[model samples]
Target: MGSEVHECHLVCGPPAAGKTRYARVLADRLGACLLDSDQVTERLVRAGLLLAGRDPDDRDSVAYKEAYREPVYETLFELAREHLPRGPVIIVGPFTREGGEPDGLAGLEGKVGQNVIAHFVWCDPDERKRRIEMRGETRDLPKLADWDGYLTSCREDRPCWPHRFVDTT
Candidate 1:
């Protein structure tokens, strides 16, 4: 995969699935550009431009997700478009919902017409719960209280894109 030129590798999974850590290692190993939603959103929030909710800093809020999630995803993919031509890129995020198919990558494929590799990270439910709790972020709602129901919500997920899967724990 390293020898492949101008590739875009999208590393996807739910929050706390270890996609960020895995992609960080992979990007360094491959010397690829890494574009991540959390990093980008953090920047936006720091800039005081991404409140999207009643609580300006509460990511767990529905209004925040409604306003920022897709926009963040779009920004990361656009950043990938700029970097991918020179080398490979790893974009890490929960870009897709827990139980949904991968859509066209913000329509980046047709525009760039380049190879876009995809991989999804998976972790054991118990371990994932532990990790999320350890992180203790504001975004862990919905899952923090009812992990079993969250699991059910994502039970039917199957990505439309053909890809590989990695177990993070």
Candidate 2:
């Protein structure tokens, strides 16, 4: 892409890692535009899934990952692009797939411009589980039901890109 760098902040971590809370504080401090995936797309995605004969609350299903994930991210990037020129843009999400990819930040820069400040927000496993349980969202039921399996699936290492680590624990 162009050498021109826009201020884009990516706040990522596993579910219940306090990403949203952290993003809110960061956005407030930076006077940035916050575009949270769950806030922007969760309801619509849930509806879309239901219409497609899928469980609306099925956040961990392969079907959701394959079909809805990319589009959901695309929508966020589109919004970020629209707001970037005005000021900093903070995007909050559990970027599990992107974090694992070697060119994750590169791919994001291509989409939402450059100078991306990536933040990986996380917490102790016990605290994460506690938050998940306290939240009590339908989408979190599956995760709570299979906590060990979820932990196994999570990537313990930091993202394969330049980023700041935020421990909410």
Candidate 3:
């Protein structure tokens, strides 16, 4: 008898699109680890190096807000690579399309060598708004600018990343 090989699953979608919830459910069902980006960022923010709110335009500030993203993403990729040997892991994050640029799925696939499954979770705008509201008391829909345009671009012009779209709305 031979052991079955496990494959990594990348769960990507826009913010408040239920990627984390779906990833949690999937992880519970499949016995896989869930790596959530928001949680990761929150953890980094809690380290006290990056302050809660600071000017985004500050060029020379070491403790400026959003400075943790680079290190966090680098840590994410490193963790993904490290977990490859331990079977599949689920990564839940915003893999948005920007200016027709290619998403990170290709680079991840190249690193993991053909055993990655990228899943994009799609949801209706109204449903997304509702979920975002219910999920948080401080939810501010106005901060999410151009939701319709972003969704349209994600559905239409985004590069093909060998993904499966699951609508959990």
Candidate 4:
């Protein structure tokens, strides 16, 4: 906080984990640029579908993932790199650290060194489910429908590498 002209703040967790909400507040408090991977993915998916001439109401479809997952994450990384040199950047996403998927911040870490801080948002299962239902976001219908599977994917209390935990509930 003393001499950091710029830094990286990552707010990460599974769906409905209050990542975007908490990250918004944190970004404002820290004067950091807030970037949400989901929002970026949404825009990418929409444009991809439009360009491909494939219309689908479901945002969770495999088609979207196939078309945009890596690209979206890479784009977010690009955006982060651009902002990091100027000021703090807060990226919100499920940037899982220990999973089979590659860490989204891997490139950034190699670039920025110790200036990056990651915060994982955790919510009680019931509270998360209630929040999911309340929001009723179309992108989450699959997760809500397969709640048990969603829980299975998040069995790790320490899901990823070294990071602070923020219990949103």
Candidate 5:
């Protein structure tokens, strides 16, 4: 007997929104594989490569961004496509409201040819800060007037995908 197949679900949201945890649990529930962006980025970082978090405005940042971020997303979609013939896959990451654009995700979907679902996890700003602090990530702790504004812009500019807002606070 053949196992049931499911569509790939892209789990996205702001920083510290529990995308990883939720993706793991969802994958388990659906008998799918979970692809985490942080793990991918950390692996690159460990290999002496800096991803987007290093220097956002630097021109050379493009190299790291393409090398790390692009592959992660591409491989994830490729894996999802490969599994589409068999089952489902769950992609967990910020897909940051600022960085992840509809065109890119659409391109991925076009490659896969349908069978994709995007979900966003939304959390209150204070709760997000607490979660970040809990995880010991202090450097990017939404501080300074400009930083706060940027975050707000990112959140507001986030594309409207089929999403589910989860309150972790």
Candidate 6:
């Protein structure tokens, strides 16, 4: 993988599934450019939420999903395209929609104009919940408060698309 160049890697999973940590190590090993959606979009997204009279840490709201998620992903892919010519690029995000099927993964390849490799990270549900609570990020307050509802929404199953499974548990 280290020798591979001009390719894009999508590292995805539910929150607290260790996507960013895995991507960082993988990027170092592959000598790839690393892009994290949170790092790229958090400040602006928080500001937007505040301006919209929503909680700045409200990442799970429909308002955030509808208004901010798409643009954040687009920016990540756009940045990936810019960095790809230099070497490999690794993008880390939840990517719930994009990791669900073959077409979605193909669409991502088209965006970067390069072969795209997808990695879906997961863990035992209990472990995930524990990690979420332990991290204590304000953004996770809603999820922690509604553990059962949040668990119902999280996908522990491997994606329908061809990809690697990273078990952080």
Clashing pairs in 1: none
| Candidate 1 Cα errors over 4 Å, as ranges | 1-5, 46-53, 56-62, 97-99, 102-108, 111-113, 154-156
Which residue runs of candidate 4 sit more than 4 Å off their true CA positions? 1-5, 49-63, 97-108, 111-114
Inter-residue clash pairs, candidate 5: none
Looking at candidate 4, the ten consecutive residues that score lowest on lDDT are 96-105
Candidate order by lDDT, highest to lowest?
2, 6, 4, 1, 5, 3
Residues 1-169 of candidate 5 have per-residue lDDT tens digits of: 3656568888887766677888888898998877776664555553444343454322123465566666666676676667776777887766663235547567656766675677777777777666766776433543422446646544533445445666555
Better of 3 and 5 by lDDT: 5
For model 6, which pairs clash?
none
- Total residue pair clashes for candidate 5: 0
Q: What order do candidates take by TM-score, descending?
A: 2, 6, 4, 1, 5, 3
For candidate 2, lDDT tens digit of each residue in 16-61? 8899999999899999999999999998999999999998889888
Tens digit of lDDT per residue, candidate 1, span 21-64?
Answer: 99999899999988887887686753453343354445544666
Stretches of candidate 5 exceeding 4 Å from the true structure: 1-5, 50-67, 97-105, 137-153, 156-158
Error of model 5, residue 76, in angstroms = 1.5
Top lDDT prediction, candidate number: 2
Q: Tell me which of candidates 4 and 6 scores higher on TM-score.
A: 6
> Where in model 6 is the C-alpha error above 4 Å?
1-5
**Residue 24 alpha-carbon offset, candidate 6, angstroms:** 0.8
TM per candidate: 0.77, 0.94, 0.71, 0.79, 0.71, 0.93
Clashing pairs in 4: none
Q: Is candidate 2 or candidate 4 better by lDDT?
A: 2
Candidates 2 and 3, the one with greater lDDT: 2
